[model samples]
Target: MAGDLVLLTGSTGFLGYIILTELLKHGYRVRAAVRSQTKAKRVLAGPSIKALAPTDEQLSFVTVPDMTAPGAYDDAVQGVTYIIHSASPIPSFGDGEPPAQDQLEESLVKQALKGALGMLESAHAKAGGSVRRVVMTSSTVAVVPFEVYMGQGTEPDRVWTSEDRIPVAPGPYGFEFQAYSAGKAAVLNASEEFVRTRGTAFDIVSITPSWIFGRDELVTDAGGMRAGSTNSVLLGVVLGVKNDAPYGGNAVYGPDVAKAHVLSLDPVVKGNQSFVLNSMMDWEDAIAIAKKYYPDAFAAGKLREDGKQPTMALKWDASKAKRQLGLELAPFDTMVKEVVGQYLELLAAEEGSK
Candidate 1:
């Protein structure tokens, strides 16, 4: 299985790139499905990818401009032994006004369903002979109820797990998070149903991870690091940024999520199952973790000692991930140090350049 060709989507994204590297590190050749050659080139040039220096046979790219298009992955899945479908639309976490309700559903909900379903359809129809497993990148939001994720109502007393399924919330979403959660839940449900009903030769493994944070090699400069995806949310705590509303205190390290995806490829691991990968995290604890790990950053005023970030302590049962994938999830402290450490490194580099 070491040299099996694996088709990977979302190689240009934060988690996708890490999954790419993990695949390569474990001796699996990857055929990355990128949106464009430019994005493919960027992944190759990333520090982690560049360090590996994957050979042509070990790493190559296919331009899949429109994943939601019919038969989008038909050609890409050819001759591939495994499919890691991690590509999906993400909501913009900027300061601007949120998109309209119709627009949100279209972009977040409809597009996600189409892309995921399309990939599975292609795999079943075209590569059923070769593809053994399809490891999908899902999210914790897919398992948790929308009201709990949105903080709209009372929090659930029980711990959420991979087996938990939440109905896709009806549209007219008030904000980005609600729509995003609906999209994930929709995809997870659709993906599992497709495999169960169709009975393809291959099985499906859905990896639902919580807030992922770690060193993002794609982020080059200080500014990019500060505004990076979920990593930014963690780093923002150190930079004295506060969330408008508190988010669930569930988190998983990036590499662990990636590793779980790779590990799921093993035939020994039973398929047609979902794995939740996360550990309970306290957002405010990031402040103390940052100060403890890298006191110099705070002393230099590079990281704030008085930053405020609200935390909603929600319990998650990720035991299935550990038991099945044999993954040891990283705690919030490791996540904070990695994010803050990388930001400080980039900040120092920026200062030196100036």
Candidate 2:
């Protein structure tokens, strides 16, 4: 049923925020698992979702501070019919040194795998018969190998499915790219192992999205750069810190990604499936579209001209998500315009307070 009880992790994150609202708007009773009860309340109290007017019975919060801890999600998983595991740490570059970078990568990959494995084990062992499915948030890095996406090789037009093996990180790739890519790839590898060894009493579906973008209504501070991994890039552009046009990469709307997670729970959704999603627009063209709608904000001195750096075309197939999940992806132009508009408002608010 569409109104089933759902437990959503990472409820205070950029994409998780949207997913939480989408679940509530669609009549699902959500028990959000966040790191802090106070922060979760602050997020749900934000004006963007206050309009949704979810009743007390419709929304709640559970604190799972350390996802890597043993049985961390046991209580959170209790009485939940579905789980949307969207919480994962974003790898950071420290001092840009190889060793520091290597350390960061190793730590992130290990913790990420451990957290995911913990959630899977908990859902299987503790949820009893209440849980039916788990939809995890993965990155397109898992689908498109870094070596090919960086234009060093002609990556096959592979349709990455649950059956596809997670590609290993190339030895020559940049530190951050290799770290993030390998971390996500490890998630797919772990998920496969979970299904193979843990059995399929509760099916697991992974949604791999490329460079998610959209307005973050919950970010009220000037630290937009810290809001999310992808948002940091977009916010960089908004703040003139990133002066490149088209920004370069496939972008997906946050709401649409949220919808994918929700739809993954549908009864028609098959077990142990993986889906790739993106809006299929170039970063440069997307910025140009945003300039069309917000000329003043994108005017000279604010937004820079195209850097003319060539970008690779999206290589992976996302048709399965559209055909099987019945997702009607939002237009890239509209998404860019809306996202920039909200970003400008945030900048204005920041300026007004200063």
Task: Give the poorly placed runs of model 1, Cα more than 4 Å off.
Answer: 95-98, 152-156
Q: lDDT tens string, model 2, 253-299?
A: 88999999998888888978888887566655655676677778666
State the local distance difference test value for candidate 1. 0.89
lDDT tens per residue, model 1, 107-182: 8999999999999999999984899999999998998887875567655687777899988999888877889999
Quick one: best TM-score, which candidate?
1
TM-score of 1: 0.96
Stretches of model 2 off by over 4 angstroms after superposition: 92-99, 156-163, 170-174, 222-228, 235-248, 306-310
Count steric clashes of candidate 2: 2
Each model's lDDT comes to 0.89, 0.74
For each candidate, C-alpha RMSD in Å?
1.5, 3.2
Candidate 1, RMSD to the unseen true structure: 1.5
- Candidate 2, residue 92: CA error in Å? 4.2
